[model samples]
Target: MLSVRDLWRRHRRKVFISVGVLGSGYLLYKLYGAHRRRLDALERELAIQRESEELMKVQLSQIMQAHFENIQTISDVMTLPHAMHNLSCRVAEELDLSQLLERLLQGKGQPSTLTQSEKLNLWERLKILSFTRMALSVWATTMLSLYTKVQVNILGRHLYIDTARRFESSSTTESGDLVDKEDQQKFLGTVDFLCQHGMPPLISDMEAATQEALKGKQLSHFFNSTALHETIMQILIIFMSQGSPHSWIKYVMPEDSATSRIDDPAPSDVTEFEQLMTEARAVLLSAEFGSILEICMKVVVNAVVEQMGAKFRGGSIAMGLPLARVLPQVAQMCPLLLEEPSKNQFIRIIKCIPEVEPFFTRLYANMPSAY
Candidate 1:
């Protein structure tokens, strides 16, 4: 080493440079540590965001899956065969032909006051009435079943389309509101009409048709199987032809009960229900509905044919069966025809109707491909 002062002066520059280098190194270390901490924080934040995104994706998938299942269930349940079965059960309960026959047989008062011929005539009239009632019941039930099928089909198709549109747009709307509020009201209105008002006019028409078909005919002539079949067919034709689409709108959405709110301020406003009614009127006028009616007619005719044919083939007519035995047997068989095998046959016929098949095809085609 040199002398202390010389050494100090000579090395001062180097000392200063070394100290500056150390200070700069410490500052660089602090900056690197801060940047590293910031990067760690950023990575943690990104991980949380990714987890949140994945959770949302899972939840959305579940919701979409649920919506898909609901639509599938609706489609499965609203078929024509299912409708026939449901409506058949309802009609069976409502009409209760067996119970009706019993009541009719139990006269309002004792028959002690009436002469023997009067009793016979009354009995004959009761038989005709019962037969007519049975026929009318079948006709009304079938028509209503077809109508229910059509209504539900239309509703199902609408929902399918709506859900598809929503899915395509990535809508966050709840599936519960898929059916518009007004459309729901209109649907309920139709159910109300059918449950409350639809049957009465139909019953009245059936009664009128019965009277017209059997007017002036002798009781024996009326009770003959061939004659009864012809008469029933005629009555059905008359009943079917009685109402136009405009007239049916009254039945579908009755004027008295069309409004959802009793005191709705805008009574004349064209509500969604009114629009639905318009659509319903259009459906009623459509060729598909006409095809349905024709199919229903064929079903009734087929039932009558099978019943009459079976009776003849079984030699019930050839053996000179008593009217008492013959009539009850026929009446009992009428309801049975609506049971298993015949019901299945009718369903097949309905499914195959040329004009109606395309609707089913389109409805199924519109179903969503993804959940």
Candidate 2:
């Protein structure tokens, strides 16, 4: 009887302990629920604030754009001194160009003066952006100066080339790949932005502004100069990256042809690249851009090669020539480059390249078409 009573008491004690633990857990769960609800509420509020901030940014941009437009309309066509005075008044009235450009690009009210960190960040972005993005940005900047009747200067051109060189230097991988995965995404994003927000504006509105500005400044031949030529070459480097298998260029200049033997069977990637060239050529031919592209190409294929020969003095004479393809390959890709005297001249130049000539000679030996 004593043993039975002891067992019963122990069982009763155990039951009380179980109940106590369950009660504590229940209270803790209720407290957790209350805290979770508060956290969720805070997150919702934060999201709402972000949306409001973006809305305000959009509104501010619209207002500033109109303000600049008005300044341009009122100031342009005025005599140089009068124009200068009007711009000065606008500046004094709190419409500084740098500050306005800051608002345009960053949604900030600060001046366009860049901190070292900001410049480093901008340089990082330059590695991935296409020439189109760079060009559009340049165009916007030029327009802003023009709108304010500011003088055209070498500062813009110098910065552009320096950035491009730095970008190109950093663009290549240790393994000789031109672009990596991260760069591809950035490049695609830049292209997307250019097509969506950039080109349309430049083609429609900014084009007129550019022409008027150049004409007004009596620099109508500005676009035809070495400034634009060098810019075009830098832009072409973006495409050159596509030609390499290990580079992101293959993806951008993707191959999209069916496989076969001799007819279209020049490797899948090569076929794809050739197709891209064909499509691009057709577009260039059909558009007004053709004339400019033609001029740029003439400058590039001829003068660029000569410049490279001068710059790189070591045993590898072609070291400076990044787009140094075999003459046969370039011709196959774009036959327009093979037109008569130019083609003959290009062949002569290729033959004279010390580092490249031996390989070209061997190629010519095996394939008559290489000649």
Candidate 3:
């Protein structure tokens, strides 16, 4: 019904509308792509920020750890003087020199066999040492009286060594004849009491006894008797028992490696000392005192080698404080204690595995044969 020119115009109008719509659509698509790119950039920036935050957290943690270590170091240094002074006073007060000296000088040649003059000199020396020890005991007791209470009641407390012996015996019995669970519990309770209560006071007394011993004139002579020397060693071990297996290791013998002279004449004395040291270590292991055992063992090894003139292998004390071999098991039992020195020692001990491996391997290999 329309003319040709009208038709052409309408057609042209439709074409133009279509072209404009297409152009708008393409522009919108481009804008969407740009928006997507911007979003991705923002996400990347966020990710980077998160990564930076994590790095900062890690750095902060390291800073805190270092700060804590610094604090602990400062605290330890500040406390050192107090610890030293207390040790000196206690050492001076507790050792009795005269009685120890007399015991040292006793059990000699018969009066008839000895010249009268030599006998008199011996008697005089013994008397002088005795007098000196007594004087020191009196002085120390007086000086420390205000601070330390002499609990005679504690002295009356005795260990049921029989119970300990019985428990040991029971462990050896045939499986069928083994002690009942109830009996085992009772024995354990007794041991706990002795360890927790009995031993502490006993240790205190032992310290006091040693102070009495060291108070005598001619302190060197007091160390001469094997019996007296043994008693002193035993007392020292007991004093060390306070911190438990850990304390045993912590003790730094007044003697250091630079000065390894036993003025005491009995060369055999070292054997006895080593035996006691080994026994203390064995007890610690059997008790399963955790990482404290390892730390204590290291302390003991250091003291014996450096202070007590024991021996050494590698740079470490030769006495068996085998950290590498013992630490993994200890860490398993007490992971909480594994950090810093313990961790470092654990690593060192691991490195020493090649050196100590033969000893352990041989031990394990021999076990079946022993059975």
Candidate 4:
């Protein structure tokens, strides 16, 4: 139907179109194959690298732990200057203590020679940790000093009072309810970490530091400084957060039932009361209290009130004029703090104590001016 030239032109066009389709198909196939090959190679390389990294981590952990033990052995009885110098050398040479501590806590650092069962002896476990912390303290001081200083000046100063307000505001919410979910989780996570991995190490560190300070005649000096009070209050706040709903103080200071509940011999003097109030006030001003308020208000404040009331009822306070005066002040600040029947209970319990009745009567009479 077509002329020779036209037919030939049409045939060339078809041939060219076929060639282009084939070329495109071939190119696509090659690209797909290359992509698959790259994926396979990448996966294999990643597997190998991960295995190598894991092995290295294990080896490094073991080596570092060995170094720790060796250093501990050498420095345990060494003079303070010598010990501190040795620790500094280790920090400079081995690894930053912060990194080391992070790895150690994650269980990715050195493998312990002791089995899980073998490491349960509280005292022995503490000794080992104390040795490590003593070395790490210097590093901690260097690393955290700047950060804590800023926090103390800026955030820390307002933390306790702010926390109390926050806790009061948050009482209506559910356990995990927060506008910022991530923050809530982070706080809960920190509580868990302290409960599981932190407390023993902390107690160990404190005990060790106390012993060392005593040896150096630094206890009075340390006590006089706000630093020690802040630290203790923080620990106590952590404990309060993790404590049971019922009796946090009871758990901490178990009742000695042998003593009479009625009279209890009127606590001789007020030294114990003074000591306790000092501790409580210090705790009330720490970051821990702020954190507690941030997490939950009704729960913590109620707990604090209950515990404080228990101290009054459970013979923790005695006949000291200073204590009587201070007790009224604390009551004024916290102000029958717990909600509902619990708050009534706090007031009622104290009222029932014959020895404390006169103080409360005066406290109640003078309440208007006190605040």
Candidate 5:
């Protein structure tokens, strides 16, 4: 070692270099530690986010599955077979053709402002009219029943989709009771409308059509199955065409005090309900629906014709006509009465709407096997 002053002057540069190196190393270590800590925090946050996403997925899946089950249950609840059986029974009771015929014959000579041939013709025409009216009643009932089933299926699916979407976006979980209460009320309202408003008016319309078609026709003219079929088909087509699809909304979703609230400005489901109604109207106007309606009309018309032919063949009535010729003509008229190009377009469009395809399948499956 040299003297103190001499040593300090010589080592000062080395000391300053060593100190600077140590300080820089310490800073680098601290910065590395901080980066590692930040990365760890980020990893933890990412794990939490992934867990949350998985939870959300499970919840959404559960919600959708529940909705699907609900839709199936709804379909079972609105069974068309049960409804049709009930309707047929009620109609048979209300329109007893045998009793009506007996009554008509009982008053045969009671006083008429017409000749004997005229009275006989009048009685025959009335008999035919009664049969036509009965057939129309059955047709109207079948149509309305089919409509109710379709409406319920479409609206029920719509309601489930809407509820699922809502539940997905919301943080709060769904309450089963609340959803059931709302859905039940809406569906019940549809039933009420069908019974109280829908069937009565539709039946009345069909009855009016029968009256208009057979107003002045004689019994022989009425027996011209080709002309009769064409006339009835035209009336049916006009009846179907007269109303806008929107006119059916009331029957599908009847208003009820239960669905409304006095405190709230508007129901949360109003917009969704309207959207569903729009979709339903679209389905109604779709070609698929038209094809179904056409098929149903054919079924009803054929059944009526078959029944009439059977009655005629069995000589259930005293008409003097030969059954062999009349029955052949009637059988020939059993083919579809109307065909329109627009119905094809509707069918094509309906096939593309996958969401509604299930409904169509269900409807077609539920139709009478003869169809």
Candidate 6:
């Protein structure tokens, strides 16, 4: 039989092999724990990055939305010729200076009619009209400038977000990319057309790549849409009008004085925002497309001259060079003017005018379609 020492020596390799196996298992377990911790940390970091990215997207969306609102406002401003035209007639009916002057000069059989209050009221109206005229003069010129800039950058081209931002910044700050000459005539020429016939409100607020989108909309369709004006107000909300956080609470919960409303600054006046916007639009439109005073004066002059059988300022043109484009627009608005008997009488009156007779004859004489 083998002795104890001899058995120990022979089994030594087996003992060592078992110890090696245990050591390797412990090392693997530690490595696995470290790897799991690293994986968790990486996942957390990725989640944080995703949240930041989403926040950035939201901010970007708000900026883009504000930008588009401004563009629509500008476009709407350009298209207000028709609306302003109607507004002009209303103004004339309300404020007839001739009658007022007549009353003032002759005293209407007594000076009592033109009291201090009446004088103050007349002065206020005059001041308002004068201010409107001045504001429109400046604003309309700026709009023309902006239109030239937009067309040069993206009239026949696309409007990228960066380019649009440039436009917005340029409008506010008057510093950005330069506009090309190609845009100059394209935009300015349209101003004449707008003054003559007035534009229809745009169909969609989205910018179209081509001018075809703007060419042929019906004015009768968009006679009273308020979307354009409201869009301008939205722009005001984004840039100029600051909404008070607790102002609504005051309106809703008037008695609450937990901390006292006096602790906060007085609520900002939001109602004036609409007033400011409408006035701005009106002023710009009036300046750009001949003021109410001017249009009314033209009508009065046209009537007096037509009664004397004279041509109106040598046959003014628009829409394929029609003589006196304003008359057609005036006719469209007046049902009495559109009747066949009235139309024939008006034609005869025009035929008798010296400057108009030759132009009308030339217009119809060569064309097979003419009467």
How do all models score by TM-score? 0.58, 0.24, 0.33, 0.23, 0.55, 0.29
lDDT of 6 by residue, 1-371 (tens): 46777887998788788878888888898999999999999999999978966875675556555544454454444423332343234324432344544554555467677887775555444323222222222222223332322322222221234444554454434444222333323332343332233211110111111112222322222311132222222322222112342221121111222321222222364232222222222222233222322332223224322332232334322112221232232222222211232232332333344543343233222221121
**1 or 5, which is superior by TM-score?**
1
Q: List the residue pairs that clash in candidate 1.
A: none
Task: Give me the overall lDDT of model 3.
Answer: 0.34
lDDT of 2 by residue, 87-189 (tens): 2232233211333334335623443656656754443232222223322233222222221221111112222333345444653223422223343223222
lDDT of 5 by residue, 213-304 (tens): 55665554424444545555655665555467434334334434234332342467664344434444455545666666666665555555
Question: How well is each residue in 155-209 modelled by candidate 3, as lDDT tens digits?
Answer: 1110122223434454424343122334322322221222233333433554454
**How would the candidate models be sorted by TM-score, starting from the highest?**
1, 5, 3, 6, 2, 4
Model 4 clashes, total count: 2
* Tens-digit lDDT track of model 4 for 1-371: 46978888869988888999999999999999999999999999999989976875565456444543433332222322232343334334432234334443444344474345443333233333333333233222221211122212222212223333444464424353221334322321221222233334444444454344333322123221133223323433443444343223221122231232222323654332232222322332344433432333223333344454445553332222222222232333232222222233332332243443343233223311221
Assess the local accuracy of residue 251 in candidate 6 as a C-alpha lDDT between 0 and 100: 17
TM-score of 1: 0.58
Misplaced by over 4 Å in model 1 are: 1-113, 172-176, 180-189, 222-226, 243-274, 311-326, 337-349, 352-355, 359-371
Say which candidate scores most in lDDT: 1
lDDT of 5 at 135: 42
Residue 140 C-alpha lDDT in model 3:
21
Each prediction's Cα lDDT score? Answer: 0.57, 0.35, 0.34, 0.35, 0.50, 0.34
54: Cα error in model 5, Å? 3.7
Off by over 4 Å in 6: 1-8, 78-160, 163-330, 334-371
lDDT of 6: 0.34
Poorest stretch of ten by lDDT in candidate 5: 332-341
Candidate 1 C-alpha lDDT tens digits along 276-369: 4444445555665666666666666666556565766664543344444556655665555355333445444554557566654553343221
